[model samples]
Target: MSDINIELLINTYLVPFGLKILMAIAVWIIGGMLINMIAKLSRKAMSIQKIEPTLAQYGESTVRVALRIALVMVILEVCGIQTTSFAALIAAGGVAIGMAWSGLLSNFAAGIFLVILRPFKVGDAICAAGQTGAVAEIGLFSTTLTTGDNVCVHVGNGKLFSDNIINYTTNPYRRVDLKCQIANGVNPQEAIARLKIHVAKIANLSKAAEPCIEILEFNASGIVIAVRPFCNNNDYWQVFFDTNKAIADTCAEAGWPVPAPHQIEFHKD
Candidate 1:
């Protein structure tokens, strides 16, 4: 090929193409960094305004996704692609896209409702869709939870919103229910009295509510005494374990016999 023809080819196609590619990469990197900064600033602003953390996080995530989408369109425009035409194409296929992404749309809707309803918030310990944990984040499509075992779980908002939600952290305090089984010979009234004293001494027990100790029922094993203590949600587990220990210690100190099942034998001829 002639040098003139080669120079024309390089200038006309290669140079422009290379420049477009570089521009696209620059836009992508810079756009991403800017989006992150904006999101961070927005979150900080929300914090300053005392906005709810759950809503703040969800807003940040949604804004970031939207900005990223716009950035992609800008990059496409830089690459000699017409974003207007692309948008038009998407609009033309909106029905098909909506049908294909029905579940995602439903999840998004459910997430909005979750935020609006404020059933549970970030850091709340809730059981939803059979998963119990502290809510880490409420996203557009799902909610993140950190379980007692420290497992991170992401549950679909649709499923979580549709199912029963038990928000343990909503109330000021929760009741810790424990059962004590005493041998038939042990006096139920004495056992109940002892339990009340020990359970009252448990650390973090709620001062707002007194411990309730009463005979629950008579079981095959023995007389079942219900030991109920109230404590803040944050101290629930501690109070629970401590209450159990209190019951055991009370039984041992009283020298009560171990509860065992009793059965009557009969012979029919």
Candidate 2:
């Protein structure tokens, strides 16, 4: 090749390629900044509309990802690189990933349903999947709960939705089911009357529903008393513990002893 031809090749080929590279980089940087700004705006808008924090965060992330993907395609086209093959490859990989992690994808989908449906909200006490707790957070894949005992648990949304959910805090009032045992010798009617008096004195107990006290069963141990009352959900534990203590104290004060398991002794001559 002639020296002049060599110089022409460097200017025409190498310089243009370098410029294209620079342009691609500049486009990526500018596009990335704009995408970030849009993501922030999306988050702010969702927040203003009172969307769940986890859902809003997931939305922002999804938007940022889509924007970056489009930016990559634009940059490739600007650099004279064909992206149809790239898009096809990405689609193929996505399908493979989806097939391989179908369970996880289902959980993600269920999480989205949970957010949109609002089956339960943050701070609500719920019983689902055999676990009872207050909802701490709802994530894209899992829902977090803080149990009454203060232990944290992460439950997949798929499992949560698959089972029945009991939202204890959905209503301001909750019906408490309590069972108390008294000495078999005690009169069932008398015991029930004593219980009603004690139940009335408990704080936060609802007066809308009259307390129910019934003699449920007679066992070898003692007569079983079933008590049903209404109270605020927030006062569930308090009312439960207090009512139990009061029943026990009242029985003791009345000279009634709770029955203990017994076995007959026999001797043969």
Candidate 3:
């Protein structure tokens, strides 16, 4: 009779418990695979629709996370755990969870706004959050930027969204502001003509907008000539340096005296 009772207990509880554990493991593995497949399909669909890269990536991540959470709940149910009770527990601790994840939540919200607003996109040259660089990636928590000096930086999305954003690549061309000082004795008209001629030969200069060479102002240091040139954003640095060299070369070639601050001395006898 004792042996029979032992067999019944094992069959009633142990066998079912073992089966439940195995099923839970299977569900977890299968659920994970499905989540990955859904994420991939979502990305492909977004790509086909010609969505922005940042938005597509963000959508994929969000879908993956939500699916993973659902998978966990399914696994808990398979293990004979009450998912409704678990959800209630989470709700009960909502205040504490919110406090602990306040920064992350803010960043996530900011990222959503960034995707919707479309202020800037991947590969755009932007200045935001005191960092100027090409946007490399937009993540839920932070934005990645590749600076001109080749350093990668990550700025929190919350900060980036709250700050002012300057997108340099939005315009057809950007103006390079440069100043060239000429001696007071030099002819401003002649200097302007020479500089313009020199600047015109620079490569990558915008043909639609001619180089604006004009006398800006005069101060302690002779006449300040504003050498403003328009060029595509990609070639801004190259054009900037080339224009500067052109100004120096033009002044030297013209045998113009170097600009110097003038001071008058009154002598008492």
Candidate 4:
């Protein structure tokens, strides 16, 4: 082949290829910067609108990912690359990933629903999925809670959404349930009267609703008395513990038998 012909052939192949590669790189960088900027702006706007931080973060991440994917397709086209096979590959990959991570995706979707619905916010005490705690963080896949004892727990958003959520702090007050077992021989009316007196003296107890002392059940060991009083939800634990202790001490001082299971043995062989 002639040198000029060889030179022409090289130029024909290398020049366009080099130019297209440069264009692809430039597009990728610019597209990436634009996507990032847009995502940040979206997050700021959400924040200004008083959206939860967790929701804002999830929104920004999702927007950035979508933008990046679209930018990549544009970059490929700019580089003179046919995207038919590439698009098919991406679709197939996505399908496979979706199938493999269906559980996680479901949780993510549930988290988004939670963000929109606003069932419970951070710092709210809630009971769901048999776990009771204060909400610490809400993420794209899981919700974090800190228990009364300060143990941290992560619950999948799917599970949280599927189960019944009891928001304790949603209402102003909660009824504290207290159970006291007294000897069946003791006068039920007298025990109830004493309980009412003690409950009346409780400083922080809510008097909006009258306190109740009902003879709930007669068990093998004792007569089960149910004491229920209303109190602020924030004082639930305090009221519960205080009432139990006070009931025990008061019954003891009054010479009442605190019912407990007893065993008798007969020996004859």
TM-scores across all candidates? Answer: 0.92, 0.73, 0.87, 0.71
Candidate 2, residues 1-269, lDDT tens digits: the string is: 99999999999999999999999999999998999899999999999999877678668767886898899999999898789887788787997877888989898889878888888887789999989999888777788899988999999999998999999887878888888888757788998888888888888888677778898888777788998778988888898888888787778777887577545789998
Clashes of 1: 0
Candidate achieving higher TM-score, 1 or 3: 1
What tens digits encode model 4's per-residue C-alpha lDDT throughout 177-260?
A: 888888858888888888888877776787677778889898877788899988888888888887887787769777987577
Q: Worst lDDT window (10 residues) for model 4?
A: 256-265
Ranked candidates, highest TM-score first: 1, 3, 2, 4
Worst 10 residues of 3 by lDDT: 256-265
Residue runs of model 4 more than 4 Å from their true location after superposition = 1-44, 52-86, 260-269
lDDT of 3 by residue, 86-163 (tens): 999999999999999999999999999999998999989999999999999988789999999999999999999999
lDDT of 4: 0.86
Better of 2 and 3 by lDDT: 3
Off by over 4 Å in 1: 1-3, 92-96, 267-269
RMSD of each: 1.9, 4.8, 3.3, 5.3
- Candidate 2 at residue 75, lDDT? 95
Candidate 2: worst-modelled 10 consecutive residues by lDDT: 256-265
Tell me the lDDT of model 4 at 215: 94
Model 1: pairs clashing at backbone N, Cα or C within 3 Å = none
Candidate 3 residue runs with Cα over 4 Å from true position: 1-26
Q: Pull out the clashing pairs in model 4.
A: none
Model 1 accuracy (lDDT, Cα): 0.94
